[model samples]
Target: MKPAPFEYAAPKTIAEALDILGQNDLDEVKLMAGGQSLMPLLNMRLARPSLVLDLNHVEGLDGIREESSGLRVGAMTTKRVLEDSDLVRSQYPLLWESTVAIGHAPIRNRGTVGGSMVQADPASEYPAAALAFDMEFVVMSSAGERVIQAEDFFVTYLTTSIEPGEILTEIRIPRLPPGTGWGFQELARRHGDFAIVGALATVRVESGLCCDPRIVLFGAADRAIRVPAGEACLEGAPPSEASLTVMGDAVFDAVEDPLSDVHASAEYRRDLARVLSKRAMSEAMSRAS
Candidate 1:
């Protein structure tokens, strides 16, 4: 199938892009980033838009910038660029790991971080990373720009707080605190396949006790679910097998209503979520020591 007829717009500046979007909104317009996801949907006739504002030509939104706060990535940055950046690998190892594992070489080459994120796939690893790292989304519309927390950005399945005529411009990742260690784990059918269950655990151990540990789980619900119960179980507990078990159990118990896809039943996914949470937490704790 081919996409329905649509007009295209290439804006040179951020303001220009937003202006295009604002104008097209009057006629049901859509924004096109890398076209990795949108084009497929267009080809399959799943989405028919009257206008597509191509953001590729938009300026100042395609590189990584390091700052005192953390790393700020342009929305147009490709997955391949992220995976290859030494700065990203050393500073934000969790982000690098997630990028490398998402899709394969070709998909990574064309897929943009902003696209994957705004696409808001429930099983996408980046959303979980954003939540774990406490990332921020910088969005703009004709109304002007404002920042939103990662957790609050996702409103529902395949839906976000990004409103009409708004576009995501950058993601702000804060610098990791001293003694912080991060780990990412996923259970997938294949090396690059979407995870049936995914876990991201960051443990900061201070003075031989768990402190500031966060275990955020994805691929288990309509959106990413942060297992606060698991993190709480580790709080003030000694880094030992018993604490680990309690943490894992808490993560399993946290998911009261998990989704059931044809690939995996809710029961099996819940079990994987438990095991992966435990394993990921153990590894994260080890590095924190």
Candidate 2:
């Protein structure tokens, strides 16, 4: 299938892009980053926009910068760039693992960081990683820029808090404290396939007790979510098999409405969530120690 007829614009500057967006009804204007996700939808006629505003030519929106707080990543930065970044690999291993897990090398070569976050696919790794790391999304429009917390950014499947006419410009990730350990796990049919279920965890062991533990899961809900119930189960608790089991049970119970698709049943997804949560937490604890 071919895409519906649409006007196309390649803006070299964000101001130019914003001007175009302001003139058109947002529903009729679709923003194109890397086109990895949107191209398929366009080809299928699922997205019938009157205007496809391409951002590829836009400058200054594709790099990684170190900040005192942590790192500031441009939204248009490609996944391949992220995967190959030594700073990312050393300072944010969890993010590095998640980046490598995305589809294949070819897809990563063109898929933008902002594109995946805006796509809001429940099975995607970035959303879960965003929540686990408490990342912040920076969006811009004529009104100016606003930062959205990860917990509030993702609203539902294929949906986000980004208002029409707003463009995602950057993602802010905070630096992990010393001795913090992280883990990422996903179950996919193939090595590069979308995960059927996935879990991400972070832990800091203090005096033999888990401190500031976080557990996030994707492919188990309409959006990636942080499991406070699961986190509560592990907070201040010894990083033991028994504690992990209880935390896993909490994570399983928290996923009340696991997505049911042809790939997996709701029951199966919930079980995978439970199992993966335990494994991820165990790995995080081991690394923390």
Candidate 3:
């Protein structure tokens, strides 16, 4: 089925976009970036907004540049560019690896980073990467702009803290400290399908002991969730096989109610979480040393 008849607006500037959003209630308006996900919803008649704001023509929202904080990625920047960026590959290899797991080349060519984050899909890879890195989102509205930490941005399944009249403008990822090692792992039916379960890990080693370890899991909860218990298990501990197993178990146990659908059962998801967590932690440990 085709989307319900709706008005479309292409704003050349962010200010104009914000103005449009300010004029309409969120229930009546929808923002369109790559349209990889939104278009499907529209075509399915699941979303029937009165106005659709096309952000493709919006200026100053599609570039990547270096900043004192780390990398400043415009919300409209395509996933393909992110996967191929030299800076991301060299400095943020974990993010690059995670991006590669998103859909396929065709989808990545048009899918925007902001779209995936805002969509808040439980099976998406970007949210897991964002959680591991403590990424910050820059949100803008007519009132002005505000920075939101990744943890706070994602409120629940397909929900976020972004209010009406607000749009996600940028993503800021801090540089990983020296001795930090990272890993990303996911299981999918096919190379480009959404992950049945995904895990991302980052570990810092000092004096042969693990420190500042982060373990994030997706497709196991309402949103990307950090396994603090798992991370705590690694703190000050040697990154050995036994420790990795324990950490994975902690993560697996932390999942409250694993979502079960036609793709997999909750029991299967829990097992995947355990195994993937171990693999990710082990890879991170190997790189840390």
Name the best candidate (by lDDT): 2
Cα-based lDDT at residue 20, candidate 1: 75
Candidate 3: 10-residue stretch with minimal lDDT: 18-27
lDDT of 1 by residue, 175-264 (tens): 778778788899889888888889998888888999998988889988887888889999989878999898878878888777898889
Which ten-residue region of model 1 has the weakest summed lDDT?
19-28
Per-residue CA lDDT of model 3 for 210-234, tens digit only, reads 9899888999988989989999999
lDDT of 2 by residue, 114-219 (tens): 9999999999999999998889999989899999999999999999999999999999999888899888899999889999999999999999999999999999
The global Cα lDDT (0 to 1) of model 1 is 0.86
RMSD of each: 1.2, 0.7, 1.0
* Candidate 1 lDDT for residue 131: 90
lDDT of each: 0.86, 0.94, 0.91
Best by TM-score: 2
Give the per-residue Cα lDDT of candidate 2 at 205.
98
Candidate 2 lDDT for residue 52? 100
